[model samples]
Target: MRISVLCDVKPLLGEGPVWDVRAERLWFIDSLGRRIYRCTADGAEMRAWTVPHAIGSMALRDGGGAIVALQDGFHAIDFETGELTHLVDPEPDKPNNRLNDGKVDARGRFLCGSMDTGESDPTGALWRLDPDMSLHRLDDGIICSNGPCWSPDAATLYFADSFTGEISTYDYDIATGAVADRRTFAVLPKDRGGAPDGATVDAEGYVWSACVFDGRIHRFAPDGSVDRVIEMPVCKITSLNFGGPNLETLFVTSMAEPPLPKYPGDGPQRGATFRVEGLGVTGRPEPYFAG
Candidate 1:
């Protein structure tokens, strides 16, 4: 598939692309820039809000605002008024840990993971936040937690630890929001300098993952077989998801690596969002955080 530039903004670390069906818009973030953005389907009518803390990821809430993973903890952000309502801080003492990639499940529960800022510790953990405002720790020993998505049937869950170059799957109990039977699903090409960043599942049960430094998106079948690969123009592909009227368009987010010393701003295709049209597979609707 061919990649087309969707938005031209340069983000230090752009990630978390969420398609809002009701609003007909796409929401994403510049993590390092501490900004959250929204744009129309065609990448027009762009708007953004600058936050006080680093934003790892976010999800659209049911009524309004957003459930945001800030540097210290989770908060409800009112984009219109720039108001942040304090939520629970899962990691109160781990100053180096911050929330990373996340998504809502079919049961209306939000599942997210955290990562150590230095990318050198196994202190990160996957967490579940229920609609009743309860938090559950799912897994630990994750270094750089990144991707967290579910299968099309909601019977399995997929997550990745970018620092370890490992992607794993688990048998999920949808009713209880519990996962069991952890197995290695895919391994990123560590020698090639790419690590699995963020991922999403397609209608055909294919797991599409962005290789951060490899400049490619890998599609894996249900059995963990490589099904297809999409080449990208830039490295540091941070995250991706399906969006559009029919969920046929795949939107990708990227980050510029090793900022230039002289100019520090001159780079090609870095920190830009892209769209892959006609991907042949459709994406399921991203569930909103019901809290």
Candidate 2:
């Protein structure tokens, strides 16, 4: 499929693409730039706001505003008024850790993770924030938590520990938002290219992962078999999610990290958002955080 550059701002770290079906708009963030962006489906009327500080990811709330994973904890952000309501800080003592990639699950629970600032220590972990505002730790021992999504049926959880180059699957309990039966699902190639960063499952049950530093997104079948690959012009493919009115447009985000001597493919769109269409596939509407 062909992909086109959507926005050309070239952020320091363009990540967290979320589709707001009700608003008919797309929201994402630049973690390093400390900016939150929103735009129309066609990429016009785009606008951004400089947040108080870095925000790793965010999900639209059911009523209004957004539930965001800020550097310290989760908060409710009012973009129009630039207001923030503090929620919870899972790791207040760990000053070096910050929140990372995340999304809302089928049951409207917000799922996210935290990682070390330097990205070399195994202090990261996966967390779940229930609709009642209660927080729970799901998994730990993560170095760089990246992709965290669920299957179409909501019966399986797919998460990637980027530092380990492994994507692990778990048997999901949708009612309780609990996951078990942990097993390695997909392992990134040991080449110079980086591991999987952000991922989402499609309507047909295939997992699509953006391999950061690889300049490609890989599609894996239900049985964990690699079936397709999407080549990108930029290397730091940070995250992606299916958006647009029909949920058929695949929106991708990237980082502005310069190409390393060993890894190439850094282009003008390195930190810009992308849209991939004509794939003849559709995605389910992402559930908003009910809390």
10 residues in a row with least lDDT, candidate 1: 257-266
TM-score of each: 0.96, 0.96
- Give per-residue lDDT, candidate 1, residue 276: 97
Q: What's the TM for model 2?
A: 0.96
Flag regions of model 2 displaced more than 4 Å.
258-265
- Candidate 1, backbone clash total: 0
Q: Among these predicted structures, which one has the highest lDDT? A: 1
Model 1, runs deviating above 4 Å: 257-266
lDDT of candidate 1 at residue 154, scale 0 to 100: 93
